[model samples]
Target: MSLPPADTAPAPEKGGDDLATLAKGGRTNTMGFVIRLVARIPFLVIATRLYGAEALGRFASALVLIEIVALICSLGEKRGLAQRLSEGAGENRSAEVNLVYDGMLLALGYSAIAALLLLAFPEPMFPNGTNSPYDLWLVATIPAFAVTEILLAAQAYRFDIATTVRTRAIVEPWTISIAAGLFFYLPGTRDAGLALAFITSIYAGLLTALWPFLRTYGLPRDWRPAPRAMLGMSASAFPLVGADAIERGTRLLDIFILGLFAPPQAVGIYYAAQQIASLPQKLKTSFEPILSPVITKNLRIGNMEAIAAQVRQVGFWIIAVQLGIALVLAIPGEAVMGLWGPDYVAGTATLAFLLAAEVVASMAVVSESVLVYIARKRNLAISVGIIALQAGLTVALIMAARNAGFGDGYQAAGAAGALMLALAASSLVKALLLKHLLGAPVSNWRWPLVYAAGAAVVVGYAFTFLPEWIELVVGIPAVLATYALVIWRRGFDEGDKVLFRKNVVPAPDASSPS
Candidate 1:
């Protein structure tokens, strides 16, 4: 395929075109979320039911370190790559290609060192113990995962969100779910099923991303390793890297803390809740790929007002959808968790808090999309403070639960509550900072959201009166429908309705045109 010139690409000067682009991405990813949700349930069922809580807990613990390390090794290219490409690529398609490969090379190098260190000292990953000898091989996934991020980001720079939907939302989850099931039944692989499955999925997703990346960017021509230039790139990315790590850290830090204070079963239960809550989180994070490129383009043209408008538009979209999801899952949290097994039912409270956390974190996540460009140092500082605050609150709350002689479930709920609080604080602070920086109001809140949520809660509460199975089967849709109907009718203005509409092309008149 012949690549389009970077400079000739559509600039979102018109608000309608920008929103349409965002809505298109949102719709694709919303479908991807549904696909991911369906695919993820099977893995949760398999891991929690077959492997049991202790094994799942150990796997979850190890994954926290592995994923965080992988993200760090990627050097914030997930968002930074968009800015780099936007500023540097100009009309030179080859420059764009070379820029992406620069990040890829850096990520590969960092991942190699990180992987080797983890392979040498594996205790940080598996704090409890190894599930199997094959677990150690997970270190190899670091490079693949890191490289995949840069490739996907490069694709996103061209507004190719479908690639992300295909790789992250489809290939990754299905691969893991299927691989985990198959590995569980294989001889000598049961103990290592989850770890091995994760490794397999990361590489699978990498390949899936690499295909489109090659088609879009092709192979770099006349590109060579430049350590001095690469070093400069690394320095510039430091603030972004820290911001990304700390933002992600706020989510994982709770689990890291829980592993120390509570037993494996408790961590397992909490991990299950976290995974469920992460569905909505995925919705917001997926927006990042599309949102980053749009924001960077606007920033390039010094369109602060447009940037603020985009932030508010995307922020509301995220919060409204996330709130609906939170309500649907949290209202029937017990039943949702029960699908994993009876042991997971205790995570209902944790699930509710985690869901609420994701809903509240929407504004912060969207705000950071702009902040990373305009206020990198400030953003990094705020992210550090947010994680620090989260750490303190999580520890205090968990210790308080323990001293008060509460069960592990309560301890886990306390951690969840702390996360909710920390994220809420992050949202407030970040939104205000963005407003100050952009000199425009960036609030996503609307009174219709309150009305919509209240109406949905009434519908959901009524469903709770029914059997658990009915609550899950029929009630979930009922609540979502009610919320969507009310929000659409009362909340969405003409502009906001773009998310549901297709980009229609007018037909040529037979009399006037050939």
Candidate 2:
């Protein structure tokens, strides 16, 4: 018995392409985020230029629902799907290829059923009897959108993130904004542009998103998954979905629930603050695609030590970056919200809560990604219980605030903070449970907490001496860059520098450690 030839085997991935893969996707997403962040300014400028507050609030409310629905449809399968395809390739290469086809069909089938049901029963689709009939039209695109999601997951398994980033983070949002602008310019399209943009952008992005994956995997040409196989995969997937819903609901449920008591305008202001806080969140999430496949494959091979190590490494990396971003945003939350609209300034308290929650939430994120692959069912149970607890707390808090003679804005802000705090608590609990189950110190993010606080204080002090706009433009980057540079020089392990070599060779034309 001899070993397989080098050429016939999988090429060894230096630094495992973990950082490079994430970097590609992160850069794309961050660019898209920056685009969206920058574009939102113009997009809002355009929207206010055209739609006014009423239309804008309605649009925000509708989008808020669409996000909820999208999260539900995703069903925690993005990472799961990628893990399956990647590990399957390692175990049985040919079978993994077929898994790709079968997985896509299963996802599309599920999405189709959900979308059609909504399309047919447009009159009361949401569980809470929320969302509009127009939203049903948006739901109709889920089948195509989710199918593309499966394709992107497949690509992620292959350690190819460029395609996923382009389609998902860049093309989709960018196209939607463009379409909204073009469509709304027409007299007849004015009212329908938002929903139409939702539908069109989903399908539009799917087209480009699927292109690369299909080129590599081909059509579902030979994929035929068994009934039990699909169900088994879905079973593992369901808890993941539950955990994700819990995670996401903790974020969005407050807005929806609180909306009943407050004016749409108040909802609009809180939502603005919510988005401002969300900027830092994307930095944390950018690592999941790269982390999932690697973690899953290691777990499959009984590499518990590796699993624990990788989880901590990825966790620290993400939290450090997210902490820095959160600090910058926290310091200028008021100024940032003011740029959105003068009225949005009322959301300063809301911004503070959400930003604080994101920093807290980052701890839960790293642990959960590993937990989902390992003790997925147990992890999910914890997530479900906590979400149930949190949702109830959020409702009671809103009720109390409303009844206590608080103003609409104050009540709305209180509800938002309570909801965010619930999320922070759940995150801490989940991390602790994950630590017990995995025998890993997933809660070893204490150093980053120090870093986040230090970054905030340092940056806040620097910006206090400067004017507002200067703080935003120069001061913001200055604070973040200083922390990043400092941390890179001190905190990071040697393995982290391997990332720099992925894109550039020899560190320059020809170089050595000499």
Candidate 3:
């Protein structure tokens, strides 16, 4: 597990290799984002139309426990692998290859233990479904889920974002969507059909991710990952694992709490809104794989300013894109939720809060990426605190709503509102902490965001006269176009074009305007 000497590590790449790689990855991830957004729609439609809210709610609740366990088993390879690999940048290629292999080995080991535990004590994980095999399918997906992460992380290190685009954005989602459709037509499968589809898609995506890894860095010929090294690597990643779990756990925590206090239908409605909100949330994640290596390389040389500029640049890019998406989706919130079915339109207000949560939380996500490298423990503490506050507020608000005689749907919306308030508060705290740590702006909140918000509001209101179908179709595009035109003209500078340009060398890192 010992790394090569720091003195022997390769010097940072000169020219614009890093930025070009980032730009290429950015384009790939953006394309993936759009594909995923589209692919996810059918799955949502099927879940709503065929299964109903109660069934979907049970599936979501079960899936949450499975995902939490998978995240635990992954040991943060999704983000931590980049940090580990970047540390060995100048070493032999075997070091990089072995890093990925070792991560997979460790993830599999953890997943094996987790799967067995879930099987032995399924009652705790799936309260009402201990006798059902649906929970078995959930545990079965862990290996594919964990290994897919490791391979995808390895390809990301190679700046091969297209592979992730293909596997994750295209193969995984479509596979699940199509599988769900097929399962729906079969008798006796409706209750657990989505679960089966999820397991199948994970395996498919695993295959797709594996091909790229083998093609790029064919099975490390001579390197047999030692058990000691694998264990040490897992131990090392525990903090990252915790941070990642907390970060993702924040979203699921709300659902878990709601399932306890609210009915299944409410959980389903809120989960539906959560699905739509998560699309813009994907914009933040798409930036992470590309940003990690760059930040790690700069951190190695003590280049704080370059790191800060990259953070701000990427942060602004995320905010702009997420805000525009939030506007487009949330402005037509009721219509968008109605796409699921009439019952889901109750989640319209919840959808807006969830979308707003994503908008502010983008800064917190970018800020934490910095802390992952330099101040991981501090980052872990903050993440724990954020989730804690969210859980407390969610429970308190839900209780108050119930005490005030609000319906279960309103109680669910209360939970969503609490999440929004918590995330906004967390973003402010993290942005300030990152600003202090980097001694430069980690977020670029400026007049452009204000102007873009105003423009979105104006355009959103203007579209009220349109039909719901027209509002969803023409209004969304119109709002996006209006927002993008204004933001592009006013907010984006020449340097900011790095986000969109393909394979073009960016100016020196220092020259990037924050």
What order do candidates take by lDDT, descending? Answer: 1, 3, 2
TM-score list, all predictions: 0.96, 0.85, 0.94
Record all residue pairs in model 3 with backbone atoms less than 3 Å apart, i.e. clashing: 10-90
Best by TM-score: 1
Name model 1 segments beyond 4 Å from true.
1-13, 504-514
lDDT of 3 by residue, 1-514 (tens): 3333122112237425555655666777988999999988988998888888887777777877888888888889778888788775455777777777778888898899999888887765553342236646688998888888778777766666787888978898899889988987888775568888988999999899876678777766467879887777877898899988998998898888887888888888989999889998887889888778778877877878877877777788888899999999999888999999999988988899999999989888888888887888888888888899999999999899889988767877888899888888878888888889888877767688778778988988778678888887888898999889889999998767777876575555433463
Worst 10 residues of 3 by lDDT: 2-11
Q: Each candidate: how many clashes?
A: 0, 0, 1
Best-to-worst order by TM-score is: 1, 3, 2
lDDT of 3: 0.81
TM-score of 1: 0.96
Q: Kindly indicate the candidate among 1 and 3 with the higher lDDT.
A: 1
- Which candidate number maximizes lDDT? 1
Of candidates 3 and 2, the better by lDDT: 3
lDDT of 1 by residue, 1-514 (tens): 3444333235455545666778888998899999899888888888898899999988888888988999999999999998898888898978889999999999999999999999999988877777899989989999999999898888877888888899988899999999999999999999999999999999999999988887888888889879999999999999999998898888899988888888888889999999899999999988898888778777777878878888888888888899889988998888898889888888899999999999999999999989999999999999998999999999999999999998878999999999999999999999999999999989888889999999999999999889999999999999999999999898887667777788732222110111
Error of 1 at 269 (Å): 0.3
* RMSD, every candidate, angstroms: 4.2, 5.4, 3.7
